[model samples]
Target: MKKMFAVTALVSAFSFSNVAMADEDIGCGLGTMVFDGKSGKVHKVLAATTNGTSGNQTFGITFGTLGCDGTGTITSSQKLAMFIDGNMDNLARDIAKGEGETLATLSEVWGIQDADKIAFNAVAQENFATIFASENVTSTEVLVNLNDLIAQNEALASYRI
Candidate 1:
């Protein structure tokens, strides 16, 4: 199960995530239509299709673009949450080690800004056990817990996305 999730995360990262760059600007900012504007079923389908072609879609999503413009499937935050859940063990290990592919991949998946990244990683490294303490934790739960951790700490507040 764990391996399966890890594989899934890798697949998602390679196929859907625009990890190479850190910029927040994305195509037409249309992804925002899903959450901020009027996004009916038709709009959602159009956005998803546009997002597919737009390599930077996830960037807009993580920064509150809601890439797909739909409640169906998963949102960018949900995808990041699941990626973290699936890779928590490796993440903890990498955080403990201070560097690894796991950490790098997660950085991209979470879309942690370059400016806020070190602090965020440090927080994750410090709170690894608390953040990933349970195998039964859902993606949403992980998100809340992580955001809460960021909220409580001044230095990590930049991670709240």
Candidate 2:
């Protein structure tokens, strides 16, 4: 239908506009990585945290990935944080698996490197998310390597597009 076609075109235009407006390279340079469509200037990233304490016995962890675009350049970096309350090993495993998988996928998409992954920082903090609050949990940070991401792109150039 003509109406349907018009709506689709409008939606496509809006989607591209939003993508163009997104903060370049989120979760990288700044203290707190900006989430998609978040409107705010990020001058400096002083600190960050991620905690997963939903219930006394329930198991879950808060995970976040931040990337930032270098000033006036395409160069960027990313920091990933995961907060765990149940088992430390479980948390590590989750990061190695769940978060790791996502990071790898993102690296390929964003042209990041594997060796660039590093523990950014960690600190104990008290986080109160409505009913669930964590008092003594350490927030860990992980950085993504940009060079490796580029190599991946080079290797997979043919498959891309």
Candidate 3:
């Protein structure tokens, strides 16, 4: 009796959750594809359960399969932040020197074309003190300062992410 009651409670919870969620709340997964366009509590619960248990959601997110957008994992700004965080020392050195592979990579990350890379590098070199600003400046601070500097540069303003 107790086991049956627990099962009933769990099912009830799932049903209530279905009501609370929007119609498209199941998200992209094998379950969503399987139960596409279906409605009601039972279908919602089954779809939710399948998506949660099968690990297809993880696969979908990683590989851009199962109707998931490939670009959902990280925004462009996030990519810039991660790159800056990982390559801070190299970036600083390159910025200070006004040219290096890392600095070139940074320009690429901002989608600056080859034609404008010279201006980008020049801006970075010219504003190195403003970008670094302090001995303990953080990656986030560096990104903000870099974006600000880029925005101020007429040739590289469009490249600011």
Candidate 4:
């Protein structure tokens, strides 16, 4: 049981270390957001030390793959990009229709004022082709592309998190 205790302790320590780094992770590339509701540097060492040749299950188990910096100091464009990635399919369909519950969720998640959700939805719908060029897009790709579209619209650029 001592060996099991040691393993648990090590994992706990590693988890805490990563969680601790989320507070000041701005502009330092991007770190994995940990389960503790904080952002921290992605520790590739977990996979290395575990002595396994499997997929990135260790990292996925410990850290969420949302690609958010978790510092809560991100710009409006970045948050919108994250929203796009999270609500990709539903958002895409909503954009095509120019309205939906999913779009409302995106507006809520972005903290957009109720009065502005309609305009924002309209802008997103107008630029759906640019935002979602293809079905297969990476999170970073979504971020960059969404930011470009946000730049063209005043309402989107006004909402920042």
Candidate 5:
């Protein structure tokens, strides 16, 4: 009787172990999108794709800024332009350590180890577009999250926005 209870408890514990080990969904900013009006209100933010492709479209958000245009809205395009927001070398080091120090990690991380180390890649069309879009210029204070960037890295499973 006591032995039966112990066996059932052990089995139940094992059954629940896998669920406990499930990976947490890490939110990383791939990079920021900035719409510099050249005269009107400027906007910027970290971006995410709907279906993980340009065909899928995108969405974005600024962390600290407040305003109607503060959120960066993404658009579909064959190609985009952007600039590196952080030190690439530093971004690589964090990824090698299985960590991220910056707001955006995809470029810096992938630049160091490729898709094997992270979840996304610059080579893939979907990732490439995102990276390109992130590099787009905007007003100061716009930043990217390393985790968001790494979420798209190929080593990890692709994510839904």
Candidate 6:
């Protein structure tokens, strides 16, 4: 019984840690909006469960209801950061090349219009060294650097997160 309890506790700890480290927010939904300012394990769990069980989160994301933006698209920087984190290698390569599927997808994620894609790609390729400053550069650092680069460019300024 003691061994079983220990194992369960270990699993629970891992689960909680993963959730705590999640890049995205609880998400836009009725439950999330209702519990927005509340902080605590219990409130978080309740909000998450309510969003998941009621399926309101999906509904909100799709229809842009509740606190969700009406674009039916990824409107959160956290989600964009998560995407960059997951695709760092591909993004680095794409950015370095000035054009690729990953880079194009990232532009889309940033809501960059087709007219500005050339400028966006050009800026990314030109500032590859700055964006990926070091071999150990992290996703957050990459995002910051990329945003800074975008801000410096008049054509790409509006796309800066």
- The 0-to-1 C-alpha lDDT of every candidate, in the order given, reads 0.60, 0.29, 0.76, 0.57, 0.31, 0.75
Off by over 4 Å in 5: 1-125, 138-149, 152-161
- In Å, residue 112's CA in model 6 sits off its true spot by 0.6
Candidate 3 lDDT score at position 18: 31
Question: Candidate 5 has what TM-score?
Answer: 0.20
lDDT of 1 by residue, 1-161 (tens): 99879845644544464433211222233343333344466665565455556443554445433333222466667677767756866866887766688887877777777887777778877886677668656545666777788879887665565
Residue by residue across 1-161, what tens digits does model 3's lDDT show? 99879845644444334322222446665566567678887897788677667576676556555554446466687788878877999999999999999999988887889999898889889999999999878778999999999888887788777
Candidate 4 lDDT, 114-135, residue by residue in tens: 9888887887788887777787
- Highest TM-score scorer: 6
Ranking by lDDT: 3, 6, 1, 4, 5, 2
For every model shown, the clashing-pair count is: 0, 16, 0, 1, 19, 0
Give a tens-digit lDDT track for model 5, residues 1-161: 99879845643443343221111111122212122221222222222222123321222113211111224454211001122233444433443444555413443423443434333432232333333334432211122333355455555434312
Prediction RMSDs, each to the true structure:
14.5, 16.2, 11.9, 8.7, 19.5, 10.3
Superpose all Cα atoms of candidate 6 onto the true structure and report the RMSD in Å to 1 decimal: 10.3
* C-alpha-based local distance difference test score of model 5: 0.31
Clashes of 2: 16
Question: Which stretches in model 2 have alpha-carbon errors above 4 Å?
Answer: 2-4, 12-20, 24-91, 94-140, 144-161
TM-score of each: 0.46, 0.20, 0.56, 0.52, 0.20, 0.57
Candidate 5 residue 148 Cα shift, in angstroms, is 1.9
What is candidate 4's CA lDDT for residue 138? 54
Regions more than 4 Å wrong, model 6:
1-75
